[model samples]
Target: MQTKGSLVGDLVKGGIAGVAGTWVMGQVTGYMWEHEDPAARQRYEEVTGGKYVPDRTAEKIGQILGLNLSEEQHSMLAQASHWGLGAGVSAAYALLRRRYATADAAQGLLFGLLFWAIVDEGMTPLFGLAEMPQVYPWQAHARGFVGHLVFGVVAETVLDVFDQAS
Candidate 1:
């Protein structure tokens, strides 16, 4: 049996992941992404008449990091990631509260992000601990900034649910 797969626990954990990741990425990599550039991707949406736009994590860190996910790609990817994250965090949060309560889901969400950015990212590419080789558009970043927000928000909600339980 899983010890902490409940809604609250998962949300709390996810939130922690976001904040922690944000901090470390900012400090270590000196890069943080929050939104897509209006110039490139924004124009594409206008041209294609696409309804979706890329949203950055903190503020598209592309300029700073010199890594290219592009305006169009970022916009589409962000949406997919956001959806997945929301689902994952909410599900986890609901399950967590069945067993216990924690007064720190928001903090938990933050921590989860921070840990993933600094520790988790390196696990695959850095240490080769295990090869996850490839991931989908959203999965590549779910654990990044996109997923954490889902974690934080959902976890916070789950914690509130736990409060009701008690």
Candidate 2:
């Protein structure tokens, strides 16, 4: 098993990386909207269920990074990038909890998805942290469900590695 210290390292590294990576991905989405194929926008929009607004996405990402991407498709790409980052965070947290059974993974996931809603959809837009549109309760659930499940699985796998080491 990894020493407890290493586990903590994983937790911190995972969380920090999740946040930073998510931010960059948001910006990248903004870039893609501007530079990518026109049909890409329609595909992205269809996939995102019309939640992909290029201007708002660009505004949100620019607010976080202090940069501008006015193109519609690049903005969409950044928003799209969030799927992986969200999944990574979920997976990392799941692993952390697995490593330390005492870790409150349920709580972590609850706070995480809710945070995604309030912060990503609610507070970010509320405070102009990001210009993205607000999410409804159901959408929050969707984000929570997919994200937490992925996280749980990833975390379980990580713990399995520890078990092997032990």
Candidate 3:
């Protein structure tokens, strides 16, 4: 049973962990993308309309708000949205961890899978932020899965460190 202060502390730690996880996930996915076969990558780009999902989402949001953002502004907004989602979701994961010790089982692998399925496989397409999951090349799906797995592991490890230091 966490006190209010402890809950706040947990959330802070989780946000930091999430930022770290997001950075690492980006690196891993970037590497995968760079090494992906040209034809497959081109196919993915074609099906997904050639822009990164976050960028597309940002553009759509800007349009909705009637803000004519420059390209740089759009890029910044896209990055902010990406990191914000990572931190926000990870903070929720931390709360879940507080209630259920089992939530940390497999070093957050299940949490990662749930995140991938709910956000990547389901919500993004449902919300029109991304193309349907089936339209992507298998490699894209593989990269997303691996990246989330890494995110879960990294976030859990950081939280463990925080626990040890406290």
RMSD of each: 13.0, 8.9, 2.0
lDDT of 3 by residue, 103-158 (tens): 34385787778889999889999988888898898999999999999888888878
Off by over 4 Å in 3: 1-5, 103-107
For all candidates in order, the CA lDDT equals 0.45, 0.49, 0.84
Which pairs in model 3 have colliding backbones?
Answer: none
The best candidate by TM-score is: 3
Q: Per-residue alpha-carbon lDDT of model 1 for 90-156, expressed as tens digits?
A: 4454455445544455655663565356534554335333223242133334435554444454455
Q: Can you give the TM-score per candidate against the true fold?
A: 0.31, 0.40, 0.91
- Cα displacement (angstroms), candidate 2, residue 155, comes to 3.4
- Of 1 and 2, which scores higher on TM-score? 2
**Against the correct fold, how does model 1 do in TM-score?**
0.31
Kindly indicate the candidate among 2 and 3 with the higher lDDT: 3
Assess candidate 3 and give its TM-score to the true structure: 0.91
Better of 1 and 3 by lDDT: 3
Off by over 4 Å in 1: 1-78, 105-107, 114-154, 157-166
